[model samples]
Target: RLAGSAAGWGFQFQSPGFVVAVCWLLFLMGLNLLGVFEVSAGRLGQVQTGSGRGGDMMTGLLAVIVATPCTAPFMGVAIAGALGGSPVMGVLVFLSMGLGLAFPYILVAGVPGVASRMPKPGAWMGILKQVLAFPLFATCVWLLWVAAIQRGVTFVALTAGGVVLLGFAGWIYGVGQRRSMLEGGRGTVAFCRVVAALCVVICGAALAQGLRAAPAPVVAGAVEAGVEPFSEARLAELRAQGKPVFIDMTASWCITCMVNERVALDVPSVQEAFRSRGIVFLKGDWTNRNAAIAEFLKAHGRDGVPFYMYYAPHQDGVVLPQILTPGIVISTIGK
Candidate 1:
């Protein structure tokens, strides 16, 4: 809501604090899924009473948190269009997308026969829940990789320690819940809760200390055969010389961007085509926030990374599809 309004609060992708926060959130969620501890509403005790609404709300929240960083090929156009238009349009577009995502579950739930055919609760469900935890764990690993790229090794080390603390907190909390159920002792439960809270606090303190320290210097990577760092001045210089240029705006955290690079941009044939065609490749690293790159994306009617633009000499820049194949790149450059 804030993003669409005049407030225009743009998100900084790969921010150290944001990345660590998400990492911890996912790590804790994975622990929950693994049965370390169940989340409680405390005040809204109804949630724990199996009304089903709480689970639905949690599913929706998890989906939004994990999916926000992604700009899928199919939805890229719709998202860009929404962001470029009035706030009303943005809200409507997002709501429509949400409906699209939820439609499958809604259908199954609404259809009596479909619901009847679903399997009844059993021990298999417990096994399945534990299985699902792995994916969340994998996602945490990926986020840590993003943190390493942006903030370097020190950040990752501190974040890893925080993960340990979180796991310990979850464990202690689970022990408290079990004891409270078995022995029904209030004092014991209160002591366990206090210890768990302290662990979490210490974890937060460690993360804060890590963030206060300056990040390790980013070592310059070896330049690829035909690629150069992207900048507005360089783009203009190439255009003035009437040279064809291909701009790759990407980020380390963008899975689609990474896939496209491996499958399309880095393919031998694509590299050969660039060499033969005398095309200049400018690679923009949006792994960390860059205002210039953000402005370029906005100018091109996009609000996220994985943006690709091809500028032919004497012609306007052409935006390529979000999902690319080697054939797509070769053919685009061939033109």
Candidate 2:
């Protein structure tokens, strides 16, 4: 669905993005931990709870949102193609994608024997729910690392502090809920509400402060050594002059981008090719949002960072594969 609306669909994929997604997932998990889901589902969280279809839909939605959809193999091409076409086509494509993803759940729902064979609800379900939260927390840690790279140490510390504050608030809310449940006092519930409010306020203020302090300009030089900042104007000028150019749209957070840089693009032969052929290496850092690169990606049937294209003299841009080889670069651009 995101790709279907790709023209104006822009996401920074930054710390704030990570925090919002993670926070929501944590909130849902908190509810699950506190037995909100179980109670609502009549203790088993089973399909017979009257929201079977809704639960399946939510699962599909969460899969799309929590996981970066474009990173999957062939997903970029499918979404990119969908986005480039008419709106109706795009929507159909997205719907098809959703249906394909949800097929497994549909199968289980349709087959009673399959559902019956599933693990019985027991005390272990609670343990499994808690264990699942760890991956989300680990994701928070990864986002903080990327944030440090984009901003600085202070920014990272502030973001970390915000996480700590959120955890403290959750703890307070948990305690408050416990007291309210056991004692059934209006005072306890009121105190819990107050703490939740404070948590929201403190977290917002901390994030705002971090943003204000982070004036670090997104620089191409910061992307990698000897790579020029990408601009459409510069690229056009070079292409008009019949000069060869290589474009790298990447983000620090993209592991594929880093791996490609280290293994293929930054190798001696690849670097030497640029020096010999005068391949103007321009990098668009999508660590932060840039509308130009976003559009460019869409134009080339690509939806995200780590997209590579080579514009040869007197020729249109040749879109390179996501995974680059030293020989691929040397032969394609070196010649």
Candidate 3:
């Protein structure tokens, strides 16, 4: 769940078209954390809710989803190598990630010893579950900070407010759940539950309004000072003309991207290399979701930003290491 939350808040939403989805998801998680629907659904699904052969097929389906947002260390190198190979290899590379996510559940189903040793659910389980919720909460806070940096205070305030509303709704729902559990009057429990549901609905609507009404982000136009903006059409045009192009796929919320830019890509020595090598330094500002850039990243087995690639004159591009130094950029251009 921490992975899911971080994936949504940091990696995925750096692009456009993902904010609403994250907001909705965070809201849903809020409900879950508050114990809103647990009362209705009874216990959570089995460790093997979808573990049989047929259900296991969904592993491949979930592969790309899990892979698409985690810019983990060594992940880029492995993915780039796979993408540089055959299509089958690339699919396998992606499927591996989904399989990892489903591994825990699969293990319980496949290994009797593991399942037999598992502690039965009881009051103690609730304590552990609540402890897990803290990590999710921390992830949300981290995401809030990231959102502020990328989308600004207005967006952060709106989003933070929405999160608050979801929490309030969850608390109300939890109150209702406790009442019912305590065998309180059915009418009172029903009233509290209905009220809680209403709160959640209002939160959804409020969030939608905030998302739609939010102002467009302002680009700092840093490239006019030196760098060139990167686009699919522009990149193809340059490459077809036998130009040397270095593409930087970056986002505002990406710490790695920022450090790379400051210490390597944008340094004075690297800028000189660009001039000497006649390299066209094109920047893909993945600070917001651009479908073109997203597709380009995926084509190379990348699920998130901070992608660095070099296209030599009339040649297939090469994926550069995600971690960069000035020497690295200069050396690549000299090639």
Candidate 4:
């Protein structure tokens, strides 16, 4: 179910953060397996005598993350069918993929002896816990790299250093009997956690806003084009212009759509064609959830973004291919 949500929400394995997150999680699991760290499961710690089923679940989740990019043989067809089908069908396709990935673990967990054969809890778990810290450290590095790509190197470096320092401070507090650190007890820890969470929220919001505010890239030899969110009245007006209307139904989360916009759509030749031919460029932003856009998608038999449609003057809309090329856009507009 989570896998489906992730995929639907444009969180693909190809995404840098997704890759880093999976690797970091796996590293943490391996550490647990080696008995370096012990995660408490409330009062049930005694009954749960194994490397840690929670860690295993984490492993399973990582497995899904890694597998998402490889689009299985029939997966592409399934996704296409689902997108063009009903909303229920779209959801079912995502659910099916999740179940397929989770099947192995589900089968193993269901077996009687499989769970019992797991290693019993032991003292060596502490060693495993320490070793697992390295993976967490590695994950921090990966996240920094992703942040650098999306935002900038300086922001990522500072954030990474801050996290490392915080982790070190926490470790020191755990090890030492310093009066200032120990006296506050749960209150201090809880307060610190809240502060950290708030910092994260602020940083994320700032980053998103910064990215949004950044200037759109310029494509030379092409007239400056603007795309507004879709509206029925606007479509009718464009149709009245007696020119081809290239309707781009996209969301902020759609990587393929972004790629096309950055490459094909922004290319000089593509832009020139649109300009000379008087092609009306229409963009439907579906970044946030919108019932109007949802209805628009349903009416057109599509369930997701990167849904390209070419409307010939006074004719029905023609759905364009998902994977776009400059020639495709030009040719469609010329027709």
Encode model 3's per-residue lDDT on 37-140: one tens digit a residue. 45312222233363244444544443343235445444766655554566688679767865786789889999999999999989988677666666656656
| Candidate 4 lDDT, 1-335, residue by residue in tens | 33443223333532434433344344434444443333333313334544466555555565555443334322545765765567899789878877887776777789868867877789777667667667666654554544454435544544554454434434443333233355746655565556545654554454445445543332211223455557778888888877678887665345566677888888899889877877778777654445666567667655566778888888988877777899998887777
Could you tell me which residue pairs clash in candidate 4? Answer: 35-125, 35-128, 35-129, 36-127, 36-128, 36-129, 37-129
Choose the strongest candidate by TM-score: 1
lDDT of each: 0.81, 0.69, 0.67, 0.58
* Residue 198, candidate 2: alpha-carbon lDDT: 93
How much does candidate 2 score in TM-score? Answer: 0.74
Per-residue CA lDDT of model 2 for 1-335, tens digit only, reads 45443342224355454544355445545555554322222322355556465565565655676555245334766766676677798889889988888788888899999999989999998798777767766666666666766676776667767666666666666667677778888787788769877976877777776676744543323745677788889998989999899998887667678788899998898888898888889998777656788788877767776788898899877888877789887877755
List candidate 2 segments past 4 Å from native.
Answer: 1-59, 69-73, 113-127, 149-154, 180-186, 205-214, 217-221, 236-244, 253-255, 266-278, 323-331
The TM-score of predicted model 3 comes to 0.62
Order candidates by TM-score, high to low: 1, 2, 3, 4
* Steric collisions counted per model: 0, 0, 3, 7
Q: Candidate 4: TM-score?
A: 0.51
Q: Rank the candidates by lDDT, best first.
A: 1, 2, 3, 4
